[model samples]
Target chain A: MQGVEQGVLDLDEDVNRYLDDSEVTVPETYEEPVTLRHLGTHTAGFESAIDPDVVADWDAIVPLETVLVDQMPPRVRPPGELVGYSNYGAALAGHIVAEAHDTTFEEYVQSEIFEPLNMTHSTFAQPVPDDSPGNIAAGHTRDGDGFQTVDTVYINMRPAGSMTATARDLAAFMRVHLGAGTVDNRRVLQTDTVRVMHDQHHVRHPAVTNWRYGFHEYGHPDAGVLGHSGATVHFSSHLVLVPASDVGIFVNYNSNSSEHPPPGTVIDEILAVCGLQSSSTEPTPTAQPGSRERAETVAGGYSLSSLPQSGPLQVIDVLEHVSVEPAAQNRLRTVTLAGNTRQWVETDPYVYHEVDGNDVLAFEVRDGEVERMYMASEPTGVYQPVPAHERQLVTGSILGVSLAGFGLSLAGWGRQCARQTWKQYRTETDSVTEGEHTE
Target chain B: MTDHSESIHSQQSGHPAEHIESDERTRSLTWLARVAGVTLSTVSLGFVLLLLVVIESGGELTLITRPFLMQVVLTLPYLIGFLTVGTTAGAVLAWWHRYWSRRVRIHHTLLAVLGLGFSWQLVRLGFITL
Candidate 1:
C-alpha cells in the first residue's frame, strides 16, 4: 500500500511486471495474470499447501527470490475466481515493493511504513536482531498435563510471517488505518488512499463476509468490523479495526492452547466494556418460508478451496471434509472432521444465521445445486462441493478395509511360519535318533 | 580339514541361508523378498497405525492445519514407493515359486496382494500419486 501511494507500484498492474526474474508459474491454461490487487484480496487462486515450506533453522533460510522461483506453488485455478488466503501472494507483493524501491522488503518497510508509524519494536529481521528493544515472547504448546515452551521457527518468506511486535505497536498501526492514515496528527497516508483501502476490494458475496484491501469483514457485515488474523504453530494474533466506531483492537497471545481463550474473546470483552459490541441481544429473526427446502439444496460434503487441490497435502482435504446436513425445523448443521457442530437457521433465501451465534452461512445456489458456501467468520476462504470419491467416508472406509486385509494376512503368515518351524524341529529330532541307532 | 572347511565356507557364501529362515529358504524366497515383505507389513502398517493413533487422539482434524505434521505426512510417498515396487516383485515371485505348501504359498501371495491393495488406498486418498 505504501508502494501504491507513492506510484512505485500499481494495484491493477500484473505482479509479473515488477519481477526481474522468477515469475509466478501460472498454468498454461490460465491466461489471466495475477495482479497486485488479486494478491492483496487473496483472490489470486493459489492452491498452496498450508505451509509455504519455511525453513526451521534460521541458517537454512534462503533468499526470497530462491524460494519464489524454485518452490513456487502451482496455480491450479484461474485468478480472481476464489479467495484462498495465500502467504506466497503476500510475500510476492512484498517482493514487488522491494523491487520497485531497489531495496530489500525489510528496508523498504522500515523506511516507509514502520519508522513513519513509530513501530519501533517491530522488525522483519530474523531472530529480531540482537540489539532490538524488547524481548521476544517464547511461544508455548499444550503438553499432556500442562504447557511447554517452544522455539519460534524462522519464516523464510519474511513478508509472510516474520515479524516481532507487541500489541501496543500494532494498536498504533491500527489507529493509523482507523484515523484515515493519521494518528496523533501525523499523516502516514493520503486520505484518499486510506479511503480506497477501507472500501471493499473483492467480495465473495454481498450478503456474506467480504474482503477489504487487506482486512476481512468480521463481526456483522455492516458493523464495519474488519480484522486480520495471523497464526503460526504456537502463537496467534488478531487485529481488528472498527472504522465506523473509530475503535480498533489488537491482541497477541504467545500460546495457541485449547485452554487459552481466543484473541477474539479478549477483543469482544474490550468492545463490550467500551459499549461497542452488543450482539448478544440481537434477536433471531423468524425462519423465512422455504427454509428447509433451501437447506436441502446445500446439503453435502465441502472442501475449503484454500486447501491444496493437488499434491500429497490434498489428503488433508480428505481428512478435513466439512459436511452440511439438513436438520429439523429448517435448521442446517455443519459438521467438521474436527468434531465441531454449528447449527444455522435460515433468515433469508440462501442465507442462514447461526442459531445462537454471530456467524452466517450463506450458500450460492445455481440450477438447484450448491456452488459455493460462505461462512462469515471464515472470510479468508470459501468452501466448494467435495466430489464423491474425495469425501471422508469413502476415503476413511478404504483405509480401514485395507488395514484389516494387511493385518489379517500378516497374522496368517506368522502362524504359518510358527507351525513350519515346530514341524521342522520334530522331524530333525526323529531323524537324529534313527541315525544314532544305525551307527 | 582345510579343504573341507574351505568347501563349507564356499557353500555358505555362494548360496543364501536356504530355509524359509535363511539361504535355504531360497526355495521359497530371497533375502530381498523377506525384507520387502517385512517392510510392507510392518513399516507401512506401523505408519498407518501411528497415524491412527494421532487421529484417535484428536490429531486428525488438526494434522492438516499444523505444518510440522504435514511435512512428515508429505514425505511418506517417496519412502513408501520402495515398498510399492518391492511388494509388486514379491507378489510375482510368490506366484512363480512352487516349493512351499499350497497354504504357505497362498499366504505369501495373499499378503503381497493385500499390501498392493493398501498402496492403492494410499493413492486414492492422495497420499500416493497414481
Candidate 2:
C-alpha cells in the first residue's frame, strides 16, 4: 500500500505485469485482470491453496516461487465476483511487492515496514534470525494424552502467515497505525495511504461487513474496528485497532488446544477493560412477517469463501458447515463459524443482529435473488449459499443405496438359510422312510 | 427263491430312481447357489457405487490443508469397512462358482472386476492424491 502511496506501484494496475509469468501465472478466468487492490482487499476470487507437505514436514521449506507455482490454486470464480479471503492471494500481493521494489519480499518488508516502525522483534525469516531478541515462544499441540511442544511450522507462503513477533514489537507496529502512519519522527506510510487503508473500499454487501485495504471492519466507520487475525497449526493470534480511540490490542497464544479462549473474545474483553465503547447507535429494526418470502431465501447453508474447494484440500469445503433458519418472531438461528448456535434479531429487511445485538448479518441480493451473505464476526464475511445439489445429491444417494443394499442382502441370506434347512429336513425324512421300508 | 429274486429286482429299480432324484436335487442346489452369487455381486456393486460417490463428493474435495496424515487416520474406518465388504462379497461369489456350481457366470465376473476396481480406487483416494 505504501508502494501505491509513493507511486512505486499502482493499486489498480494488472498484477500479472509485476509477477514473473513463468513462476506465477494467474489464469485469466475472467476478462477483468486481477488488480493489486483486489489482492489487498481479498476480492480476487482465487481458491485457497494449502500444500499438505508444509503441515507435516517442519523442515520441508520451499521457495515462495515454488510454493506459488505448485499450489497455484485455480481462479474458480470471476475476479471481484465475491470476497473470498485467500492466503494465496495475499502471498501473491507480497510477491508483487517484492517485484515492484526490486528486492526479496522479506528484505522489502524489513527495510520498509519493520525498520521504519522500529519493530526490532518482528522478522519474516523462516528460521528466526539469530540476532532477534527474546526467545521465540515454543508452539504446542495436543497429543493423544497430553500437550507436546513443537517447533514453529515453517510456512511456505511466508509473507502471508510466517512472521514472528513479540508483543512489544506488535505494539510498536500498531503505534504507527494509531499515529496515522507516523511513529516518533519516522513515517512508514503517508497519512493519506493510512486513511485509504482504514477507509471502506470494497464491501461484499451493503450494510454488511466493510473491508478496508487489508483489514476487516467490525462496526460503523465512525466507531469502527479494523484488524486481521491469523492462526497456524499450533499458534493463534489476533490484532485489532480502533482508530477512533487511537488504541490497538494484540494477543498471541502459543497453543492450539481448545482450552484457550478464542482470540476474538480475549480482545473484546481487553477492549471492555479499557472502557472503549462504540459510539455507533444500534438501530431498532421492525420485524417483517414471513409473508415477505425473501426471508426464507436466506435460510440455508453457507460456507466461508476462503475455504478450499479444489485439489485434495477441497474436502474441507464439503465439511465446512453453517446453516441459517428462520426462528420464532422472524428471528434467525444460525450456526456461527465457531460452531456455536446463536440467534439473531432482524434489524432490517435482510439485515440481522446477533441476539447479543453486537455482530451484524446482512444478506446480499442481486436481481431479486439472494446472492451472498456477510457476517461481521466471520473470518471471511462473504459466504455463498451451498448449492442444494451438492448437499442432496451425494448424501441422499449414499444413504439410500446403502440401506437398500443392506435390506436386499439380508433377505437373500434369510432365504438361502431357509432353503438349506428345508432340504436337510426332507433328506432326513426320506432316509427314515427308506430304513422303515428295509425293515 | 422266486420271491427273493423279485425283491432284488425291485431294490435295483428303486436305486436308479433314487439316484435320478438326487441328481435333480443337486442341479437345483447349483442353480440356487448361482442365484445367490448374482445377488451378492449386485449388492456389492451398489456398495462400491456408494463409496465412490462419497469419496468424489466429500473426501477428495474437502480435506483441510496439509493434514493428509490426519485425513488417512479419520478415513481408515471407512476404508477398512469398504475392503471388508468387497472381499467378503467377492469370496462368496468365487466360492459358489468354484466349489458349488463349478461354473462362472457373467455376473460373477462383473462382481469380481467391480470389487477389485473399487477397492483400488478407495485406497488411492484415502492414502494418496486422487
Candidate 3:
C-alpha cells in the first residue's frame, strides 16, 4: 500500500511485472492475470491452502521469492471469482513492496510501518531479531485435561504471520489506522490512501461483511467496525478498528483453545464496560416476508473453502461441514460439526442477521440454491456447498458399515476355527474311550 | 483354509455332507477378507491411536509443515481404494458361488456394499478422480 501511495506500484497493474526473480503466471485454466488489488482483497484465484511453507529449521529459511516461486499454489479459479484467503497472496504483496523499495520485507516494515508509528518493540523477523526488545510470548495447546507449552511453528512467509509485538504496540498500530493515517501528527499514510484502504474494495453484498483493502468487516457492515485476525498453531490475536468512533480494540491470546471466548465476545464485554453499542442495545432487525421458504432453500451442508481440497488435509473438509436448518418464526440456525451453533433472522432476500449479535450471513443464490455464504465472524474464508456424497450422513454410514463388515468377518472365521477344534477334540476322546473298552 | 474339498481321510471317516458344506470357504476369499479387514482395521485403529498421540503430546502442527509427511498421508485414500476393489471382487465371488455358509455369504455381501459406498465417497472428494 505504501508502494502504491508513492506511485512505485499500481494496484491494477500486473503483479508479475514487479517481480524480477519470480512470477505468478496465469494458470492455463484462467485467462485473467492477478493484480495487487486481487491479492490485497484475497481474490487472487489461488486454491485455498493453509500451509505457509514452514521450514524444518531456522537455518532452512530462505528468501521470500525462493519460497513463493517454488511453492506458488496453482490458480484453481478465475481471478476475482470469489475470495479464498491466501497466505501466499499476502506474502507476495509483501515481496512486491520490498521489491519496489529495494530492501527486505522485514527491514522495510521495521523502518517504515513500525518505526514511524513508534512501535519500537515490534519485529517481523523470526527467532525475533537479537536486538528486538520485549520478550516473545510463548504458545500453548491442550494436553490431557490441561494445557502444555509448545514450540512456536516457524514459517518462511515472514510477511504473513511472523509479526511479534506487544498488545500496546498492536493498539498503537490500530490507532494509526483509525486515525486516518496519522499518530500525533506523524503521517505514515495519506488520509486519502487510508480511506481507500479502509473502505470497501471488494464487496460481496451491501448487507454482508465485505473485504476492505487489507481489513475485513467485523461484527456487521453497518457497525462501522473493521478488523484483521491472526493465528498460528497455538497463538491467536485480533485487532478491531471502530473507525467511526476513532476507537480501536486489540485482543491477544497466548493459547488457541475453545476454553476462551471468541474475540468478538471479548470486544463486546469491553464495549459494554465502556457504555458503547453492544448487541443488546441495538434494535432488533425485522425479518422480511417469506423467510421460512428462503431458509428451506438454503438449508444444507457447506464446506469451508480455506481448507485444502486436493491434499491429505482434504479429510478436514469432511469434519468442517456447516449445516443450515430452518427454525421457527422466520429464523434459521446454522450448526457446525464443531458444535458451534448460531441463530440467524432473515432480514433480506437471502441475507440473514444474527439473533442477538450483529454477524451477517449473506448467501448468493443461483437457480434457487445457495451458491456460497459469507459470515462476518469468519472473515478468513467463505463457505461453498458440500455435495451429497461427501456429507457426513453418507460418509459416516459407509465408514460405520465397512468397519462392521470387517468385525463380522473376523468373528465368522473365529467361529469356524472354534467348531473345527471342538470336532477334533470330541473325535480324539471317542478314540481313547474305544481303546479303554478293548483293553 | 478348510474348504469343502474335505480331505480323503475325513470323507472316508463318513463325515456328513452338511459338515463339508459348512466348511466351504475358499482360500482366495479368505485371503482377500484378511487383507481388506486388516487394512481397514489398521486405519480405524490408527485414527484412535493418532488422537491419543495428539492429545498426549499436546499437538503436532509439524505434520503440516513437512512435505514428506503430507505426501505419505495423500496416498492413504488410494491405498484404501485399491483394497476396496479387492474386497468387492472377493465378495462377489463368494456370493455367486455360495463359497461359504449363509452367514458368511451375507457378511461378505454386506462388506461389498459398504466398500462401494466408501469408494463413492472417495470419488466425490476427488481422491479418486478416475
Candidate 4:
C-alpha cells in the first residue's frame, strides 16, 4: 500500500521487475515494486505454483511472507506481454501491499479500500461473523440423490478468494468504478487511472482476441461495459457496469444448478425492463423446450455440398448445410455438419437462429416435407463477428486516414491559405477525431 | 352360560380395533419419517454436488479444503437442521410402531441420529482428504 501511495510501484516498473527476474531469481528489491494494480490487472507474470501444505488451509490460512516467498516462483511471461490470468501475480501484489504498509493484506484492503467505500458488510476472512446481518445463503450441489454441502477448500488463498460481501456491498464497489473511481467522495484510484485499468491492455493467448488486464474486458470499448466474475467451491458471483448507460449489476449464487440463470441474466433482464436497447443489436438464438408447431416445421434433414472444401466458406454454407430433428414441442435438435455440434434450435419465427454473425437460418417446412433454409452474407472469425456498422466504420476510418495523408502532403507546400483549407477539409471529413479531442 | 358367551364375543371384537388403530399410527409415522429422511439426505447430497460444480465451473479448487471446510461446517446451519429433522421424524415413527416397546423406540432413534451425524462429519472430513 505504501509503495502505491508513494508512487514507487508504477505499472511499468512492476512489469520491468517481473521481466528482469522471470527466468532466474527474483531480487528482494523487486518485491516492493509489486502493487495491487499489477496483481488485480495481472500485469505481473507471477507463477500459479503453490505449496500443498499451505493450500490445505486455503480458506482460513494466512501464510507468512517467508512461506510464500519460498514456495512460488517469479512470473512466467515477459512483463507487459499480455494479460494471462494469474492468481499468484495477485498474491505477490498482496504481499507487496502487506510489506509496504507494515500490515497484513487484509488489513490494508480493509483500511484503504473497503472502509472508504463504506462496504461495511464486506470482509476478507473465513467463517463469516455469526452476527453479520443479511442471509449467508447455504451453498448446495445437485447430485443424483439431491443437494449436499461441499466441505473442502483452504483459506490460505484469501487474498484471491476469501472475500465475503453482501450484494449491496458489491454494488457499492461497482459504484466506485461507475462513478469514475470515487465512492462516497473518497477516491480509491484516479479517474484517469481507473480508465486505464478498464482499457484493453493485453489480449489473452490461444487467440489474440479478448483483451485481458486484470480480467476479461466486458463489452466493446464503445459499449462501455466492464466487470469480472468470481467462482468458489459453492458459489459464483459477478460484478459489472455499463458506464455509458449509468448502470451496474451484481449477482451471487450458492447453487450449482445449470437451471439457474447465467451471470448476465439479471442485468439483461433489468435493461429489458427499462426498455433500453443494447448497443450491440446482434441477434442471439436461445434454445427452448415444448413447442409443437415450430418443432414440426423445422424438423428435417439438410445438406450443403456447394460449400468450398477448406479455408473460410461463404455464409450460405452455415445457413443451408444444417439438419434438425424434432426433440419436443418448440425444441429441435439441430445438426450442423460444418461445426459438427448438436444445438437446440428455438422456434421463434421473427428471431432467427444465428449460425454466425450475419447469417440467420430458420428451419421451416415449405411443403409436405420439412426443408427450408435462409442465408445472409456474413464475415466469420474466432472472435465475435464484427457488426455491419462496425465494418462500415472501419472502412470509413481507412478512407479518412488516406484523405488525411493526402491533405498533409498538400499542406507541405507551405502556403497559409492551403494549410487552413486542408485543416477545414480534415475536420469536415473526420468529425469523430475532432469530437474525441473535444471530449 | 349366557354371561360367558357374551364376554367372549366382546373380547374378540375389541382385539381387532386395537390392532387397526396401532397399524394406522405406525403407517402415518413411517410416512413422515421417510419424507424427513429423504429431504435431509437430498439436501446434504446437493451441497456436495454444488461444490463440485463450482470447482469444475472455473472455481479455485484449492479453496475447498481443511480449515475452510471446517469453518463452513461450523458456520452453516443447514447440515445440522437436516440431521435433526430427519432423526426426530425417525424417532417418532419408531415410537408409533412399537408403542409398548420403549427399548426398541430409543434404540432406533439413537441409531438414526448417530448415522446422520456421523455421515455429515465424515463428508466434511472427506472433502479435505480428497
Candidate 5:
C-alpha cells in the first residue's frame, strides 16, 4: 500500500514536471507544499482546452500528461479566481498519487483507492462493464423524434474527473469522509487531513461562497454543508454532510437537469424519508430565485447562426461575444466564458468584453437592460435552457475522458504488438541468411 | 577422370539453379501470406478500437454534437491511416502469392476490399449521428 502511494505521488510529480516546461506557467516550486487538498479544491491555477470531448480515443491518441503539457499553460488567477472549477487541479492530484508511488495514475488508483474502497463497480476505463449490476446510463438528447445518444468527452484531465464509480460505492466512500477518514477501521485520510480536505479553499462565487479543499462548502460557515458534486452526461451525483448535525446525504440522479437543483434536495428528501426534518417548518421555495434570475438573463435561449449546426451552442461557442456576470453590489463583471462557468473581474460599473479581431467590445448596462444587446452582425443571443438530454451530454463528456483513455491504450497496444512481430521476423530472417551463408 | 569431372560440375550447377529458383518462389509466397495476415489483423484491430471507443464513451453519441457529415470530415485522417496500412499489407501479400504460389487465389484482393469496407462502416457509424 505504501508503495502504491509512492507511485501515485510519482505520477503527480511527472505531471508537474511537464507543466513546469510547458507554456502553461507555474512557479518553479511553491513555498508551501502543494497537497492533494489544493488540487482537489481548484486552487491550482491550470486551464484546459474546453473541447477535450471531441477526442475519440484518448489513450491511443495521446496520454493525459502529454495533452495537458502540450495544450495547457498555467495562468494563475488571483488565489480565488471566481468559482472557476479546475479539472486540471484534480488531474494534478492524480499525478501526485502516481508520483508518490512511482507508478501510473491508473494503476495507483486501482490498487490504493479502488481496491481499498471496494469500489469494484468502478473503473477509470470507458465502456464500463456491460454486465455490471446496473446499466451504465446512456447520455441522450432529444432530437426531432426521440433521444439520440451522444459522444461522451474525454478529459486527459485525470484525477479530477477521470473516475467512474457507482452511486452505491461512491456513497460508501463518502461515508468514510463523514467518519473523518476512517472506514472499517482503515484510515484513508487522517482526521486533520480530512478537515483540510473540507476546509474552504476559495470563496469567489456568491452562489457557492465557500469551497473546501475538494468539496463545495454550503450554508453558513458554522452551519453550512460539506461535500462534492459529480456531474457527467445525464448523471448528477452529490454527497453532502452536515458535520454539525451528524447528517449525510448522497443523491444520484440520471436525469439531465442543468439547473443545479437546490443543493439540499436529496439531503432534505433523505431526511424526510428518515422522519427527521430540522427545518421542515421553513417552507421550501420550489422556485429558487437566484437560479431563476440567472436563468432569465442567460436561459431564455438564443441561437447562433455562425455556430456549426451539429452540436448544442455552448458559452465557449460564442468566444467572440462579450459576456457579463452579476457580481457584488449590483455591478456586472467582465468575464471570459469557457463553458457554463466564467472567470470575471468583480468591479463596479461592470464591463463585459470579448475579443473581436484585435479590438475588444466592452459592454455595460446604460439603462436597466443589457446595452447594445446585439452588437455585431453576429445575432444577439440569449441562453437557451438546456434540455435534460443536452445536460447529460455535457456531464458525460466531463466524465468520459478516463474511460476513453483506457480504450485508446488498448489500440496502442495492438499497434505495438504488430510492430514487435515485424521486428522479430526481420531479426530471424537475418540470422537465417547468415547461417545459410556459413553453411 | 574427365568424365567424372564433367558429371560432378553439371550436377552441382543444375542443382544450385533449381534450388535457388525454388527458394525464391517460397520466399515470395511467404511474404505475400505475411502481408495478407498483417492487413487482416490491422483491420480487426481497428474494429476492436471502435467498439472500445463506443463502449468507453458509455455508448452515447449525443455528447458529440457535430453533424454526421462534419464528424466524417474530421475523422477522415484516421480512416485514411487504417486504409493505407491495410491496403499496403494486402498488396504485398497478393504480389507474393501471384509469383510464388501455384494457385492464384484472389484472397488478398478480397481481404483488401473487406478491409476498406470495414473502415467505411466505422467512419459512417462514428461520424453519422443517426
Candidate 6:
C-alpha cells in the first residue's frame, strides 16, 4: 500500500524490473510477465516453496535474499494463468516493498504498518521481540503420547508469515482495513488505494469468490468477507473483515493441530453468532459429460511447480505430490503431501470447487492431455505431469536394489561367522592331536 | 651315522616348522583384517540404509505419508559411499585371503557387499532419516 501510494510501484508493471540480479531472478520460460498485480492476487504461477526447517529453529533465521535465491521454486506455468498460493511470491512482494523503501522488510513493516497503526505489541522480528506488549504464546504439535510444545518457527520469508502480534495490536490493525484504510481519522492507506486493494483482482474458479489484492474473498457480495489465515509449526492466526458491517475480528491460537477448528471455521461461527450469512452461496455448475475426460487427463501425480526441476533438491519432487484422483459423481479428491484430502466437485469443464468452501482448482487441457493446474489453496501452478523418472517407479527400483544388496550381505556375514567358528574348532583339534603325538 | 641322520632330520623338520609358523602369523593378521573389514563395512552399510529409508519415507518412515523420495539428494552421497567402500573392502579382503590365509573365506567379501545393499531397502522402508 505504501509503495503504491508513493508511486514506487505500478501494479501492472512487471515485478522483474524492480528485482535486481542479486535480489531475485524470476525465470521467464514463457512470454507472460509477472506483474505486482499477479503477485498480490496470488496468480504469480509459482508453486509452494516450503522448507520444513523454515521455522524449525527460530535461532536459525536466514536472510530474506538467501531464501529468495535458494528457495526460488520453479515457475512451472506462465504468470496470470492460475491462482496458486505462494509464500515465496508474497515474501517477494515484501522484498520489493522493502527495496522501494530502502530498508529491511522487518524494519519497514515496523516503521510503516506497525508504527502508523500504533500496533506496539506487534513485531516482525524472527524469534520475536522479547519486550513486546504481550506474552508470546507457545505453539504445539501432537505425537503418539500427547501434544508437545513446539518452538516458534522463523522462516527466511518472514514477510510471508513471521509477524507476531497480540490480539490488541491486531485489533488496531484490523480497524484500518475496517475503516477503509484509516482509523480514528489517521490514514495508513489512502481511501482510494484501499478501495483498489479491496477490489477483485483475480477469480480463482467460477464457483468460488475472487481474490482481492492481499485478501481472500469469501461469501456472497451482499454478505461478503475478506480475510487471511496464517499458520506456523506452532501458532495459527486469522484476521477477518466484514466490510458491510464495518466489523473486523482477529483471532490467534498458541498451538497447531488437525484437531483444532480451522481459523476459517471460527470466522464463520463468529459471523453466525453476529447474525451474518456466513455460508457461501457458490453457484454450482451443470455437469459436462466431457468433464470426466478432462478431469482424467489431469488426474495424475503432480510435483510442486515451485520446486527445483533440476539439481540435487529436485529429489524433493517426491515429497511434493498433489494427486488429483477422480471420485464418485464427477468430483475430484486431491490428496496433498501432508495427507489432507479435500473433496472437489467439478463446477465447470475443467474447474473444481471445494465441496462446501471457497477453494478452487482449475486445470488447463491441451491436445487431450492436462498441461497445467492452478490451485486456489496458495499460489501454485503445476504444469506438466510428473515424469516417470521422478515418480514412485524410480523410488521402487532404488528400494529393490538396496534390499537385494542388504540380503546378500547379511547372508554372507552369517556364513562367515559359521566358517570362523568351524575353523577355530579345527585348529584346536589339530593342536591337541599334535600335543598328544609329541608326548 | 645315527647321530648325523638325527641331526639332518631335525634341521629338515626345523625348516618346515619355520615356514608353517611364518604362514600362521600372516594368516592371523589376514583374519584380523577380515574381521575389521567386514564389521566396519556392515556398520557403514547399516547407516547408509537408514539414510535411504529416511529419504523414501518423506521423513516419516511409517504407515503415514506415502514414502515418496523426501530430501533424497542429501542421502545419495552416503548411499554411494557405502556401496563403493563396501565393494572395495570386499575386493581387498578377497585378495588378502587368497594370498595369505590357508583357509580362504568368501563370506567376508560377500558380507560387505550385501550389508550395503540391505541398507538401501531399509531406507526405502523409511525406518530411518538421512
Error of 1 at A384 (Å): 1.0
Q: If you assessed candidate 1 against the hidden native complex, which CAPRI class would it receive?
A: acceptable
lDDT of 6 by residue, A1-439 (tens): 7788888989998888888644687788778888899888777877654442354455567878778887787776688876666788888888888777778899998888888888888888877666766777777665566776654556677687678788888888888887888877777898898889888888654434568898876544335778788776566777888877888887777765354877767777888789775454454864567766666777887765655444334445565677788888777888866677988877778877778765667776778877667665543334447765455556656645555555566677689789999999999999999999999
Model 6 whole-model lDDT (C-alpha atoms): 0.67
* Number of the top lDDT candidate: 1
| Clash count, predicted structure 2 | 8
Fnat, one value per model? 0.43, 0.05, 0.38, 0.05, 0.03, 0.10
| TM per candidate | 0.85, 0.73, 0.85, 0.46, 0.46, 0.69
**Model 3: per-residue Cα lDDT at residue B77:** 61
Q: Give the number of the best model, judged by DockQ.
A: 3
What are the per-residue Cα lDDT tens digits for candidate 3 across A395-430? 778767766666666666678889999999999999
Per residue, candidate 2 scores C-alpha lDDT tens digits across A1-439 of: 8888778789888888887643787887889999988887888878755432344355677767788888777787777677778888888888888888888889999999898888888899878877888898897766667777865567777687788988988998898889988888898888888898888778676666667888877543334788788777677888999888889998888876253776877887777677664533445655566523655778888877876655435445555557788877667888644668988777677887777546778887777777888887763647888876554234435435544544555566578799999999999999999999999
After superposition, which runs of candidate 1 have C-alpha atoms over 4 Å from their true positions? Answer: A21-29, A257-261, A272-275, A278-289, A310-312, A433-439, B1-38, B49-82, B85-117, B124-126
* Interface RMSD, one decimal, each candidate: 3.6, 7.2, 3.3, 30.1, 12.6, 8.0
| C-alpha DockQ of every model | 0.26, 0.07, 0.28, 0.02, 0.04, 0.09
Off by over 4 Å in 4: A1-8, A15-38, A43-60, A64-67, A70-75, A129-135, A143-146, A204-215, A220-222, A257-261, A265-439, B1-130
Model 3 chain B TM at: 0.58
Interface RMSD of 5: 12.6
Q: For residues B4-91, could you state the per-residue lDDT of candidate 6 as single tens digits?
A: 9977987777667777997897677666655555555555555556555764433321111123333443444455445546555645
Model 6 B-chain TM: 0.32
For residues B1-130, could you state the per-residue lDDT of candidate 5 as single tens digits? Answer: 9989977987777667777987887777566554544545454554445544654444333234344544444454365445545555645655754543433234344445445544433333233222
lDDT of 1: 0.76
lDDT of 3: 0.75
Interface root-mean-square deviation of model 4 in angstroms is 30.1
Candidate 2 off by > 4 Å: A20-22, A50-59, A143-146, A219-222, A257-259, A277-283, A287-292, A336-339, A366-368, A379-381, A392-439, B1-130
